[model samples]
Target: MCRSSQTRRACGRNDVVSTWDSLRLFSPAQYSSLPGRLMPSRPGELYPNAAHVVDYLADYEKRYDLPVQRGQRVDSVDRDGPVLRVGTDSGPWTARAVISATGTWTRPFLPAVPGRRDYRGRQLHTVQYRRPSEFAGQRVVVVGGGNSGAQIAADLAHARIDLIWVTQRPPRYLADDIDGRALFDAATARRRALDEGRTDAGGVASLGDIVAVPPVRAARDAGLLASRPMFARLNTTGVEWADGTRAEADTVIWCTGFRPALAHFAALRLRGTRGHIATVGTRAVDEPRLHLLGYGDWTGPASATLIGVGRPAREAARDIADFIRH
Candidate 1:
């Protein structure tokens, strides 16, 4: 999405509003590809793995003739009156309107539990994790209750690793027939309930519920999907439960969440409560020129997911185009 406004401020050459055709955008995750999703049902429809996504993106870019300057690192986005001075590793690119669609891959949040830093076992976040084969024949504790946590724990379980899942509560597995779009609708309902200050949003299962991905389904069938209560702390050798039981683990894979990597926007001084830049829709409430996208529900409902991001991205794109045209 465009983060800059059309107002003048000693315009620079890289300004997207003036030269939207000059450069488009950038991201680090193989163009932000998700490899875990199931393949599309329609023939010739592909959006399953990272490779398929790259293929689709390549075709889209080719078809649209998008101006994508790869390898250019955005260092900072400093507000200069009506425009934004986007500082990159190469140099400054100025824009009357800039879109900050920077996704959350860069910032992996690890909860600050006692002894987490001092743990003797191999510690890695799901970010560093790939296949379960690397952790074969070892006692592994997969933390968190989200999709990654569920899938990775399932992976370990399938690989015959001594698997233990630690979560706040038992993980919920969604119906086998459920898909992301349906879940996203449920998420919308949940959000509305949250806004209305009603905790009882009955029937909408938590997005945190395991989506019954193939590996997870297999784990369920194998009866390996059981989860333990959150442990008290990490130990020198393993983790200690609140009830004082200690279990040995060769690896501790954190599936914790992440925060928005908006340190680049530090110059804007627009950050509000919970270290998030407050926004009305995608527009930053305090800084109208700035727009944030693909962060999470705070930026847009279900904005983090592939299916969810398109709406916000399209809307923000339209808004940016409109802002420039006006």
Candidate 2:
């Protein structure tokens, strides 16, 4: 997601520097590609960095001749009789159907813990985190057990910070050999099994949450990857456990995750009580003319990832075309 107005403008124009900028750049240096996926890295480059991803996306856009409307921030999307009206900073446009592909990166979620406000130390979501050096010499508590949390904790450990990595449960590390390709295959198989009325064998989730990337593996070997149980509550100085043990910290980095960036759809009122828009495939059940993409499995299995999004995207496109043809 764009970190600033300047970056937003550059991203709108599909500028390589700003499209995936900070989020990708700030990822650990050892971050590698999801092997066997589309968008292979340049020759001899097995581990692609943020710059490579940016260049790949830019090249893809140019090759496909994608027409990107620059500098327009979509404010709202509403129904206008037979069509959908999209209100953006630039103006408004009407379409027979609207596909909302805006992802969740912009909406960082921090859980409400007791005494959160009273805690005087700094608090930031993963989106706001740039590098390990920023927290130098401070006691940092990294929360959440997801990939970002694991990765961030690993990053901080290497920096020699006083770090306490806490999770709701012990962090699950995938097998050393497992990677994105394996995860995708497992998910596909699980989906097929469920479709055939068989027992739903867990997919990627069965493998584990955190991928054993090089950095995480290194930290694990060094015994710095051990995680503590989540704290009971926050205090002015730090976090306290249910057993009343406390650890003073200078900052808490929340990798708790994010909600979909769906505020623009408020006018459509598509979301149910759970704050999710029900979907049959990617098409909204309440509003067939509306489609949501790259949110999560509710839309399509693994649809949130680059390799996985293509299947749902193609299905959405086909469905929309068929709807228009009739």
Best by lDDT: 2
List the pairs of residues colliding in candidate 1. 1-99, 2-98, 2-99, 3-98, 3-99, 4-97, 4-98, 15-94, 15-95, 29-32
> On residues 54-169, what C-alpha lDDT tens digit does candidate 1 reach at each position?
44555555556667675566778888777888987677888887778665656778998888877899998877777777877789999998777887787777778888999878
- Model 2, residue 311: displacement in angstroms? 0.9
Give the runs in model 2 whose Cα sits over 4 Å from its true position: 1-38, 42-45
Give the per-residue lDDT of model 2 (tens digit) for 183-272: 777878887787789998888888898877777788988999899999989999999999999999999999998887788888888888
TM-score for each of the candidates: 0.81, 0.89
The reply for model 1, stretches above 4 Å from the true place, is 1-47, 189-208
- Write down the RMSD of all candidates, one decimal each: 8.7, 4.0
**Weakest ten-residue segment in model 1 by summed lDDT:** 17-26
